[model samples]
Target: MAFALQGRDQSLVALGCRKRYIRGPRRADALVGASGPAGSGRPHQSGTQQQRQQKQPLLAEQLWFDEERILVDESFEAAEGAQLSPHLKVAKHVGSGTSADVYKLQGDGKQPELVLKMAKPVPGLRRAFQREWMLGRRLNAVAAAASELNMIIHTGPAVVSEDKKGQLVFRGTVLEGINGKSLDSRLEKDASFCDVDFIMMMLQQVLTALHKAEALVGFQHGDLRISNIMEHSTDPEALQALRDDAQTWQAQGFVSAESAALAKGLLTFKILDFGHSKINERQARSYLKLSSPNMNTPADSAPAGSSSGSSSSSSSSSSLALQRLPAAKGPLEAFYSFWYRGRSDSWRLLRSLATRLDGR
Candidate 1:
């Protein structure tokens, strides 16, 4: 596929025949400056009122602007010693996002390197946890039946633990092992290492996973970038087999056949993270502007397809929905074929590989 730079022109089509767009109203606080009764500053007051006023502290302990204090309580370190369940031990901190903090956990002895993705105590993140947990379960079910989908990371069963008062606390989902280094890390280490053949293999596997996911789950991977792609170290024999296949494809004129260290078949790629994924619900709109990370603004939203612009509102006050273009079929298609606006991780990979190839 050719990599081209183009401006995005998407439609904001609702999923089903009757589209329902979720929009958040922009909160505009009006600061009105008022003087006591329009210049009647010194008004007489009752003795009881004056006495009560005098008793009140001039500087209230609680400030209205304490909203910004949300940052102080948003530390990922707070979950350092936290535990998911009696069996699941939340260990070292792995990563943090706006809605959740990822921790390396030790599950059953058989699965020592498990990951626990615990959502922060934010109401807005409820959907994120739900989406991920549901999607993970669906993928796992599919993988269990189909061996082709083995590439998709299978998340463990989701658990909803309670706090001290027996109230349902934040939601959490356990993922398989740490998987492998992200595609970004590998490229950062050696961008030049990705030749045409290697790119083809990676893309082939990723696209394969995407097609399966879409067909089986009826949803799209909202965020498909280098970082979201994981590269697993493979065996030497597998690497040789991949190299042989590439050579065959090259001879068939299907690929340019440029030679580069393929990391052997040693590098198998797996798609990671479903935080931005959207289900194919007929009642849902094609385009969504979530207030969570990777979904802050329309510019950062994932591609679904094209549709007519419309507007709707979300039940949560934090969410803001706008009338943008219709969603495309995931970011992968958008990346290779500039059918929409915004950055595509797949497109970036293609461009980077092209640049590296030209340099050589």
Candidate 2:
């Protein structure tokens, strides 16, 4: 059988020998048809017409398929209250940065909270976002097999789709809402943590997770800072004790030795954000160039050079300087350099506290 369709301004012909139909103008909805025997009845009376009439509109209203490929326009954003699928409800934006915007979304109640990261489809930046999704998918698969690390949030498989304007977008696993406070916020309220042994333990856990990522997976978390770590306190009494000690230390210049020790023992930690992560053989030199204004620098790394007053002038100068810096040989070297710097300080604190406690 053969079929053909001619619309107001375009024509579509499906040849049985070729088994495909030609697609037309951007404004034209695809007139999908199939060809059979030579003497086929009026094309309008064919089953394809009936099927097209019976087909429901796409769930994602702005999405469509043309010539067997998904076509999405980059200019259109998802409408307010737009539904991606029957179960997924896209809500207002939760967070946004120059690189991407994260939308707070809801899936079936059976699933966890969803955070959809829509990477602003810049030509070169899409690969990094795609890499993150690949790594997240790999980690999700591994997480299903091993339950040792609770610090890494479970990331569902990554899905690639287009927004209303046909811009490619990426969505990954639904993240469970964490109840704990960010390490940055906690530290702001209690700087005494800098001196506490519990903080050292929490740091150890974070390091352990990074080590796993390095040794087992051969991936480097390109960004690591206090804001990305979450603290979950299981014991209200323990949390209160740490808070009390912080207050006491701030007021009296010191806390009771026992309370101080107990406060240090009760620290809990979780790590978040893997957007800048790099895989074993991947070249991640571009990551350093795409720095965020709010991103924290390492405690020990040299301070960034001051800008030359003009924003454009400063950016050019900074880019030139960054270009001059030597790149790490591989992901392993980058992982060690970044993780070890933080690990050394944590180990030093642990050793010092151990000595003070008479080798406890």
Candidate 3:
């Protein structure tokens, strides 16, 4: 038998539905007698409407601008009257990646020169852009830490907005366009930096930066190759003081004259590119995978049509499978390939610089 259920007050018809007043089949007779289908039933109430309202998702704000007509877009234009000028002329493209291109930009009129990084939306590179944004945000949070540690240079404001195509674009965090050769470039032109002491000092400063980053943010630079380092000349008195110290150390037989001079000449080293850096735990695992080549090969590398012999063998002989992984070629290559391959050119350049400095 089909049962018809309805509410008590309003005349809301509910076909094949149970009545609110009825407890079970035993009470159905009483409920039917009290509230007949004619016009005595109450309204039908379901929580579906309220549930839908609560389940709605939030969306990010969308920004748009005109690229052709405006020298600077609306978002930037809004900041025009402010003391800090946002308008900058694209001088030249310094670098380009899968999702973004960095341009050395010169500010209009008297504004400070800036580095403008224009990001394009690519499905594959979206994650990289998002990761960079997250890193930038983290760096901003720990800006004070860097300052306290006297780490290279702290990053500035990183503004994220949309372009003419409505693609995500990021600006700000302007790296001061310093007028000097990069550390690698200087090492190539001059062998004077090859002194052991100089190299040690440079490495120490770099390590200090890494330590600061770890202490403040719990992450060391995954890619700390040379080309990312830039050099600035030191004060004459400071250089002379280092030279004097080197001579004193040389007299004591503590360090060689060449090493002392090189160390004295050491100026500054800046670490860049946090794109590949991972937290402590992830970094350890990544290092292991990178150092062992066998861990990178696919278990199904056996001929496509062949029986899964290798797979079965790999499963059976775990120790042998682990041994199959090759040793890392070199420390630099291992780190770059495992974590920063696409940006290997910078690292290679740095390596070349290090070699040249050693020869000097």
Using lDDT as the yardstick, the better of models 1 and 2 is 1
How well is each residue in 185-233 modelled by candidate 2, as lDDT tens digits? 7546643333333343444456555544454445556556666677654
lDDT of 1 by residue, 1-360 (tens): 233333231222111112222222221111001112212323233444344334422211111111101111122233555544445567888888887778887555634356777777775465456556545545554443333355667666444433334323225666665345786775577634434344555655565455544554455665676777776543444445655776663544332222222222234566677765655543122222111222233443432112212211121122112213233344454464454345443454444444433433
Q: Which ten residues in a row have the lowest lDDT in candidate 1?
A: 26-35
Question: Model 1 — TM-score against the truth?
Answer: 0.50
* lDDT against the true structure, each candidate: 0.44, 0.41, 0.38
How far is each candidate from the true structure, as Cα RMSD in Å?
25.5, 27.1, 31.6
By lDDT, the candidates rank as 1, 2, 3
Estimate the TM-score of every prediction: 0.50, 0.46, 0.43
Q: Which wins on lDDT, candidate 2 or candidate 3?
A: 2
Residue 189 in model 2: lDDT: 69
Candidate 1 deviant stretches above 4 angstroms: 1-83, 163-167, 234-265, 280-360
Task: Tell me the deviation in Å of residue 344 in model 1.
Answer: 9.7
